[model samples]
Target: MQQNLDYQHLKAQIKNWALEIGFQQAGISDVNLNEAGKHLNNWLQKQYHGDMEYMARHGEKRYIPKQLIPDTLSIISVRLDYMPAHLTPYESLTIQSNKAAISRYALGRDYHKVIRSKLKKLAQKITEEIGDFGHRVFTDSAPVMEKAIAEKAGLGWIGKHSNLLNSKAGSYFFLGEIYTDLPLEPDQKQGFHCGSCTQCIQDCPTDAIVAPFQVDARRCISYLTIENKGPIPVEFRQAIGNRIYGCDDCQVVCPWNKFTHTTHELDFQPRNDLDDIQLLELFNWTENEFLNKTQGSPIRRIGYEAWQRNLAVGIGNIKTNEKTKQKIIATLKAKLDESSDLVKEHINWALNQFQ
Candidate 1:
C-alpha cells in the first residue's frame, strides 16, 4: 500500500497545506546544492562573513541537506511575508535623527518562533497524510542554506544583494524548511530577475555590497549593529546614522520592493510603538525596561549593552537644535559611569561627535 502511494499528488497537497498553515508559498527541491556550496566556500575563503564563524563551521553539512539531516531526500522550502502595512517610511525615520530607525523585520514578535510554529504545523499536516514520515522543521535555527534551497525550489532567485527575491513578493519575507525523506517532485528554479538594477549595491550606506552578488559583512551596518558584539567601527559610525538596530538601506532602495506585499500576520506587526519611537526614548530604557519591552522580540537577543551602544551612536549622529543637543549630551553623560566598557566606548564616541 505504501509503495503505491502517489508522491506527486502529496507534494501538491503539501504546498496547499503550507498556505493554509500561514506560509505565503511552498516549493519542493532535491537535496543537491553543489553550486551553492561552491559559492559559500568562495565567500568564506574571502572572509566576507566577518565574525559569523558559524557560517564556516559545519563542514559540508551546511550545504549538503542530507548530511545535516540524514535520509532527507527532498527539502520543502517556504516563505512568509513579514512587512507590516502603513508603517512609518524607513526613509523618513533615517532623516529624523532623533527617531530610532529599526529594521522592520525586528519590529514585532520574534520571527524564529512565528515561522517555526507554522513550519511544525505544516509538518504535522503532512504527517497526518503520510503516517509519521521522517521530517524536521527549521526556521533560521540551523545550518540550513535556506535562501539557496528556496531558490532551487522555485520560490525565488538570489538577488545581487544575496537575498532571495520574487517578482510578486520582493524580499520582505522569512524562510523556513522541512527536510523530509519523501521523494516529492521538485519545482522548476526561478530565473534571475534583477536585470541592470544596481540600486541595492549603490545605496548600501556602508558600501557593504562590494560587487554584484558579493556583500562584505564586516562593512555591513546590519552586521555591525546586530552581529558585532563589540564597539562598531569608527569609520562606519556616521554612516550608521539613526539606525539603532539594523539597517534597511539596501532593501529600501531595491527596485523590486515596489511590488512588496504587506504581511497579514499579526505576529509580524509592530509592538510597543517601535515603529515611530524616538532615539532618546529608547536610549533611556533601563535594562529591565528593555527586556520587558523586547520580550519574545528579536531585538532582545542583542541584550541591553549592544542595544544601548547602537542607540548612543544613533543619538550622537543627531542633527538637531542646540537645546536638543545639550539634552542628548546630558543623557549620554549620565550613562557613562554606569555603562559597561562596550557601552562606555560608544557613548564617549557619541559625545565626541558634538566636539
Candidate 2:
C-alpha cells in the first residue's frame, strides 16, 4: 500500500512536469485494454487494415500493456498539440488547386523523433523522484494502440474520422506513452463528444470512413500514397486529387478543429515553398534532388520510384492545356524508357490524360 502511495504522488508530479516539457496534457491509465483489443480484432478480421501487416503481427501484445513491457502497471499517455496555430486546414486546402497536399502532421520534423525524446525525459524525471523504475517509452513505434490508450487516459475519444478527438485540444496532436511499473491512480476516461455530427464521414473525398468511428484504411488516402508499395488502384486515382504525400481532408472538414492550437515547432513549417508547389515541379525533381531535398523529411521513405509514381498521378489530375500538357507529357516520356514499370505505368496513364 505504501508503494501505491508513492506511485500516486509521482504521477501527480509527472503530469505537471509534462506540461513544462511543452506537452498540452498528460494522464495515466491502468494496463488493461481489453475493449480496444476486441475492436481492433474486428477491424482486422474485416481486412480494413489493408497493407499495414504490422497491425496484425503483434497480436494481443499491443493492448495488454505489461505484455509489451514487462513489469508495467500503468501507461502515461501524453499529447502534444501540432496544429501550429491559426494555420487552418481549410485555408491550406483552398490556397492552390494544382498543389500536392500533404498531411499537416508530416509538415514538421517527424513526430516519432520529437515525441520519443520528450517521453524519455519524462521517464527519467520519474526515476529521480522515486529512486528507480522499470519502464519503456514509445512514440508511434511498435504496435501500440495510441488512440485507445489515450481515451483510457482521459485524453480524448477517437472521433468518427478515427483520429483522437479532444474537446479542448481537438485532434491535431501527437500521442506518446511510457509504460511503467508505477501503480498510479488512473484518470477517468473521456466521453465521446462527437454526438450527432457526421462532418468527417460526409467530407472524406474517398469516402474512406465506412461508418462513424470506423475507417477502411485500404481507401484512406494516407495509406494509399504512403503505405502501399506498388501501383495505386485505378478506381480511386482521379478522386486522389493532387495529394502526392499524406492526405488531410478528414481533419480539414472537422468543425472541432477550429479550436486546434497551432504548433510552435519550427521543424513542422513548410519547406521549399512545399505548401504550394505545382505537381509538375515535384515530378520533375531528379533522383538526386529528391534525396537531398527530402533528407530528413517524412516524404523520403516512399523512395524515388514511388515518389515519381505518386507525382505522376498528381500530374494526371491537373488541368491539361497545350504548354502544361506538353510539359507534363514530356516529363513522363523523357524518363519512361529508363524508369521502373510502376513509374512507366503511371506515365502511360498520365499521357492518356492529355488531349
Candidate 3:
C-alpha cells in the first residue's frame, strides 16, 4: 500500500519534471486500447495506409502495450510545439508556383532525433527518482498509435483532421511517449470540441480527408511526396502544386492553429532557407549538393531520386512566361542523360506540361 502511495506521488512529479524538461504538457494513461485496435483494423482493411506496410506489420502488438513491453501498466505522453518563429507564411508559399512549399515540420531538423532524445532524458529522470523502472520511449519512430495514445492520455482530443488538437495549444505540436511499468493515475480524457467545423476537410489540396475523421493516405500529398518512392501519380500531379516536400494545407487552414505557439527550441528553426526556397533552385541541386543540404533534415530520407522527382512535379506546376518556360526546359534537358529512369520519367512528364 505504501508502494502504491509512492507511485501516485511519483506520477505527479513526472508531469512536473516533463514540463521542466521543455515538454509543453504531459499526461498519464492506462494501457488499454481495444477501441483504437478496432479502428486500426478497419483502416487497414480499407487500405487507407497506402504503401506504408509497417502500419500493418505490427498486428495487435501496437494496441496491446504489454505485448510490445511486458508488464507495462501505464503510458506518459508529452507534447512539444514545433512551429518555428518568424518564417514565411504557409499560404504565401503555396501561391508562389516557383517557390517550394516544404512542410513547416521538415523545414527544421529531423524531429525523430529531437523528440526521441528528449524522451530519453525524461525516462532517465524517472529512473533517478525511482532508482530504476522499465520504460521504452518513442517519438514517431515506432509502430506507436501516438495520436490515439496521446488523446487517451488527455493531451487533446483527435480533431477532424485527425491530428491531436489541444484547445489551448492547438495542433502545431509534436507528441512523444514513455511506455512504462509505473501504475500512475490516468488522466481524464478530454472531450471533442471540433463542434461543426470543416475547415481542414475543405482546404485539403488533394481532398485526402474523405470524411470528417478519415484521411486516405494515397490521396495525401504529404505521403505522396515523402513516403512514396515511385513517380508521383499523374492524376494528382496537377493538384500537388508547388509542395515539394510534405503538405500542411490541412493544418494551415485549421482555425485552432491561430492559437498555436511558436517553439522556443532553436533546433526547430528552419535550415538552408527551406522555409522559402524556389523550386528551380532546389531542382538545380546536384545529387551531392542534395545530400549535403539535407544532411540532418528529415527531407534527406526521401533520397536524391525522390528529391528530383518531387521537384520535377513542383516545377511542372509552375506558372511562367514562354521565355522563362524555355529557360526551365533548357535546365531540365541538361539532366536528361544523367537522371535515373524513374526521375527521367517524371522530368519527361514535367517537360510535357510546358507544351
Winner on lDDT between 2 and 3 is 3
TM-score of each: 0.99, 0.95, 0.98
Residue-level lDDT tens digits of model 1 in 111-145: 99999999999988887877888899999999999
Highest-lDDT candidate: 1
Candidate 1 lDDT score at position 35: 91
Pairs with steric clashes in candidate 2: 84-262, 84-263, 85-262, 108-268
Tens-place lDDT digits, model 3, residues 19-109:
9999999999888998889988988899999999999999988999898899889999999999999999989999999999999999888
Report per-prediction Cα RMSD to one decimal: 0.9, 2.0, 1.4
lDDT measured at residue 237 in model 3 versus the true structure, 0 to 100: 96
lDDT of 2 by residue, 1-355 (tens): 1253566667789999999888999998888899999999999999999988989999989988777888988889999987654443434653455677777777656778888888988887787776677788988888788889999999998898989988887888999999887778899988888899998899787899999878999998889999999899988888887888878888877888877887777777766666657777888789999888887777888899888988888878886558767777788788888889999998888778775
Q: Report lDDT (Cα) of residue 53, candidate 1.
A: 95
Q: Which candidate is the best by TM-score?
A: 1
- The lDDT per prediction is 0.93, 0.83, 0.91
For candidate 1, the lDDT comes to 0.93
